[model samples]
Target: MAEFHQSRKNIIRLIFIGVFAVIAMRLFYLQVIETKYRQLANAQAIVRKLIYPTRGIIYDRHGRVVVNNTALYDLMVTPSEVKHLDTAFLCELLGIDTATFRERMEKIIIRNSRYRQSVFAELLPPDVYGRIEENLYQFPGFELVERPVRNYPYHAGAHIFGYIGEVDSATIRRSDGFYQAGDFIGKTGLERSYEDVLRGQRGVTYLVRDSRNRIQGSYAGGMYDTPAVAGKNLYLSLDIELQQLGEQLLQNKIGSIVAIDPNTGGILAMVSSPTYDPNELSGSERNKKFSRLFTNPELPLFNRPIQATYPPGSTFKPVDALIALHEGVITPQYGYDCRGVYLGCGRPIKCTESFPGHASNLYNAIAYSCNSYFSQVFRFIVDRERRPALGLAEWYRYVSDFGLGKKLGIDLPGEYSGYIPDTAHYNKIFGKGHWNSCTIVSLGIGQGEITETPLQLANVMCIIANHGYYYTPHVVDSVEGDPDFYRTHLVLHRITANVSDTDYDIVTRAMAAVVERGTATIAAIPGITICGKTGTAQNFTIINGKRVELKDHSLFAAFAPREHPKIAIAVVVENAGFGASWAAPIASLMIEKYLRDSIATDRLPLLKRISEANLIPEYILEKKRRIDSLNQVRDKLEARRIVAR
Candidate 1:
C-alpha cells in the first residue's frame, strides 16, 4: 500500500508538469506567433475613425469671399456589422429607392471588404442631414460623416474655381496612397494648381465599441488621437466687381477679356463669355448640372482667356515697330509712302486708314494702323540680314522675349503655347531660302502662322506698360503660409533686346495718339490718359476646295494713365464688325471702370448695346437650341427631385 501511494504521487507530479508546459506554449503563441488574432479581436472592439479637414477659403483682393464652405453629411456603413434593419425606411431617408439600396449593398460586398466602411449615400445637405440624424440610431450599422462642401456666394468664375469630385482609380494609384477611393480632389484651374496647400492634412481618432457596435467614447482617453489641420486660404488678385463687369460686357459674344495690373502683373479681371454660375457646379445637384453643361454645344466649359488663339492683327504693329527700332532697321523718324494699300508681296494688302498722317512717320503709322508702312518696316527688319532665314530668326528672338509663342507659366492649368513660325518650318514648306521677307510680310501685321491668346496679348501690354519687364501674370496674390509664396512664384522677366526707355516713351505716346485722334478715338476717356490699339483680324478658312473669308474678329489692347499705368487690358469679340465699334469700347469701359469705379452716364448705352448683341453664328445658335431642349428635361427632373425631398 505504501509503494502504490508513492507511484500515485509521482504520476500526479508529472501530469501537473505536462499541463504547465502546454499552458506556457499556448501563452507564447498568443503573445508572439499568432499575434494577428489579437489584432482582429481588438479591431472588433475598437473603432478607427477618420477626421476630415476643411478645404481652403478663397478671397478676392478686397477680402470679399469668393468661395466658402457649407456642411454636408455622408451615410457610411459596415456590411458585416449590419443586421435586420428597416430597409424601406432607410432608403426613403437616404432618398434612394429599394432597387438602388439593393444595388448599393451588392456593390459594397463585391467591390469592398465587408469589414471596412463604405459610403452608402453622399452629399446630404443640412436639411436632409438634420432630418435623417433623428432616426439614424434605429439602424445598427449606419453612421454619419461630416464634410465641408464648396459654396459660391457670387456664383461667378465657374472655370476659375473648378469643382471637386470623388477620386477615381487612376487618381488613387497616382496618389501613392495619400488619397483613397472616395476622397475629393480639385479637378482644374486654381483648385488644381494649389491642391497640396489647399487640401491641408487629415487626422484620426480611436474609439471603443460595445458588443452591439455602439460607440463608447474615445479609446485610451484620446491619447493617440490627432486633430485635423485646416487648409491654408488664398488671397486672389482678381477684383470681383471688375470681373463681373467684364463678364457682362462679353455677354452674347464668344471671346475673352483679360485685364492685368501693370505694376504687379496681377490679373484684375478675366472673363470668358458664355460662362456659367459656379454655384451650379456646387451643392446637391452638382453632378447632374455638370453633365448638362459639359455637353452643351456652346462649350461654356472652355476657358477662352488662356486657351483661344488668334492673330494679333493691327495690334501687332506696335511690336513690329519696337523690333524695327531695337534692330536699328528703322528710326522713330522712319517714313514710307502709304496709299492705304501694300502692293509688295504679289498681293494687295488694303488699309482703312487713308487719312493724311497714314504714311508720315512711325508714330503716325502706328496710331493710324497703316498696314502699308508696317509691311515695309517688317521687310526692312527681315531683309537686314543677307540670308532671309537668318533675318526672320533674329526678328523671332525679339518677339519671343515679349512672351509670345510660349506658355506664360501662369498658376492655372491648360495654358496653350501659341504658335510662332520658324525658318525651318518655312523652309520645309517652301524650300531652303526660297521664302523671302516679302513672301511672309503678313507676319508684320500679326498674321500668317503667328497666333496669340488673350492672356498673352494682355501680358504684352503689361510688358509695354512696364517699359520692358513684367512679372508673370498671376491670379493669386498671396497665400496664408510662407509670405514669399507670391514672390517665389512671381517670374520677373526682362526683354532680351537693346530697347531704350525713349523707345517705350515714343511708343506710349503714339498709342495715346491712337485713342486721341486715330482709329481708336472712340475709346478716349475724359480725364484718364488712355493708350489703345484697334485690331480687325481677318478670318480665312477653306470651304468647298476654296479659301473663304468670314466676318472679321474685333480686338483691342489698352492701358490707362500712360505715365503711371494702373490697368492694361486685351479684349477680343468674335465676328464683330470693327475693333473700334465693339472691342475698343469694351476695353475702354473696362479701363474706366477699374480706374474710377463707375461708368459715366454717357457710356451706359454702349454697355447696353454690347451686352445685348448676339455675335454667335447661325450654326452655333441651332446647336444651342438643341442643348437648351435637352436642358429642359434636366430642369424638370431636378425640380421633381427637390419636391421629392
Candidate 2:
C-alpha cells in the first residue's frame, strides 16, 4: 500500500510539470516568436501611414524641366472607424450627393475590406480639400493624405510622358505586397518604360491613436519611422523646341514625325498628330477628359511613330539600290530604258516619269524614282541564284540587316514590327513554284506587302547617314543615379550592316541629287545639303466587303548636312496626295529648324501653308462629329443632375 501511494504521487507531479512547460512555451511564442498577435494588439492603438516620395523630374536635352511634381490630396476613409458621421455635410463638401456617397462606400467595402483604408475621393480640388481639411475633426475615420501628381509645365509631350493612374487588382497581386489598392502607377510611354527607376521606395510612419481613433502623436517618438527615397531623375535626348515645332506642323493632320540624331541614335523629336495637352490628363478632371479622348474616333491615344505601319513607297528605293550594288548586279552607271511603262510580266507597270534618259543610269533612276529601273534590278538580284526561293531568302537577310521587318528595341513600349514577305509567305499564297520575281515585282518599288513604321524609316536614314552602321535609337540619354547602367544597357554599341561604304556613297549621292534637282527639290534648305527621298504609298481599306482605294499617304525620309550628317528624319502624312507636296516640305522645315534654329525667311510661307493644312479624312470627321454629339448630350445631363443636387 505504501509503494502504490508513492508511485501515484510521482505520476501526479510529472503531469503538473508537463502542463507548466507547455504553458510557458506558448507564452514565449505569443510574446517573441509570432508577430500576428502583437500586430493585432498594436493595430488598436497605432495607425500606420505610408509616405510617398516625390517622383523624379524629367528634363529635356537642354536641362529644361518638362515633367515635374505637384501636390494633391486624396480623401481616404476607414469604413470600420466611420461612425456618427454627418453624411449630408460630407457630401456637400465633396460635391457629391447622398446616393453617390453610399455607392462609393459600398464599392469600397466590395473592393477592400471594411477595416482597411481606401480612397473615397481622388485628386480633390483646392477649395473642396480646404473645406474638408478645416472640418476633418468632425469625421473621425476620414483623413486627407497628400500625394504628388505629375505636372507638365509646357503642356506638350502627352504621349512621351504618358499618364499614371490607380493600381489595378492584377498589379497589386504581382507587386508582392509592395503596392496596394490606392497606389498610382505609370500606364504608358516613358513613364511605363522607366517605372522602376521613376517610382521611389515607399516609407512608413507609425502614429499613436486615441480611443476615439484620433492621432495623438508619433508612436515611440518616431523610433520606427522610415524615410522615403526619391526616385532617380531622367535626362532625355528630346529637344523640346524641336518636338513642339513637329507637333505644330502636324496639327489638324493624322500623321507622325520621328527625328533622330544620327551620330548617337538619340531621338530628337517624336510627334503623333491629334495630341492633347498633357495638363488635360492631370488633376481632378483627368477621368472625364480621358473618357472623351478615349472615345474620340481619331484615336489620339495611338502612338503612331512606333505603332503605325505603312508602305515605304519610294523611300525604300535606296535600300534596293544598295542591295543591287552589293550583289554586283548594278553599278553607278547601270541604265535602263523606261518609256513610261514596264511590260516585263503579264501585268504592265507604269512609270511616274516618261521622259527620255530619266532612268539612263542608277543616279538618275533613284533621283526620278523610276519603277522600270528598279523592277529590272530586283529581277537581276533574284534570278542570280539557281532558285527564286534562294534569291528571296538572300533578299530577306539583307533587308533584316537594315532593321526592317523587326522591332528596333526602342525604350518605349508598344512597338510593331512591320511585315516583310518571304518565300514561304509567297508559297502559301501562290503555291510552291507558282510565283516568281515578276509576280512580286511591286515589292521592289516599296509596295505590295512591304510595310514599315516611321521609326524604322528613320533608322534607315541613320544607316545611310552613318555609311553602313547605325545605333539603336533611344529617348532617355542618361539616368541621374546610374549613368553606367544606362550606357551599358542602352545602345552605346554600334550595329553594322552588310553593305559596303562604296555602295552607300553611290546611294547617298543619288539621294542628295533627289533634294538638289530631283523629285524632292522642295526639301532643299539653302546653305545646307539635304539628302532625301519622296514616297506616295497607296492606301486601301475594306468597305462593304469590297476593297476601296483611298488617297495616297505622303511620306519622306531624309538626313541632312550630307557630310557628317546630324539629323535623320521621317514624316508620314495620311491621305495626303504627294510626298513633295506635304511630307517632304514638313521634313525639310524640321531639318532647317534643327540646324539653323529657325525657318529661313524664304520658307516662312511654306511653313505657314503646311502648318495650316487639314488632311484628316472625311470619314474620320463624320465619326468624330457623331461622338461629339453624344458627349455634349451626356455633358448636358450631368449638368442637369448637378443643378438638381
Return the TM-score for each candidate structure. Answer: 0.91, 0.92
* Count of backbone collisions within predicted model 1: 0
lDDT of 1 by residue, 323-408 (tens): 88878888888887877788988789997866666768888887888899999898998899778999999988888999999999
Q: How many residue pairs clash (N, CA or C atoms closer than 3 angstroms) in each of the candidate models, in the order given? A: 0, 0
**Alpha-carbon lDDT, every model:** 0.86, 0.90
lDDT of 1 at 416: 89
Off by over 4 Å in 2: 1-44, 97-100, 106-112, 209-215, 490-497
Question: What value of lDDT does candidate 2 attain over all alpha carbons?
Answer: 0.90
Maximum-TM-score candidate: 2
User: How far is each candidate from the true structure, as Cα RMSD in Å?
Assistant: 3.2, 3.8
Candidate 1 structure lDDT: 0.86
Q: How far out, in Å, is residue 384 in model 2?
A: 1.7
Candidate 1 runs further than 4 Å off: 1-44, 95-112, 125-131, 540-549, 631-645
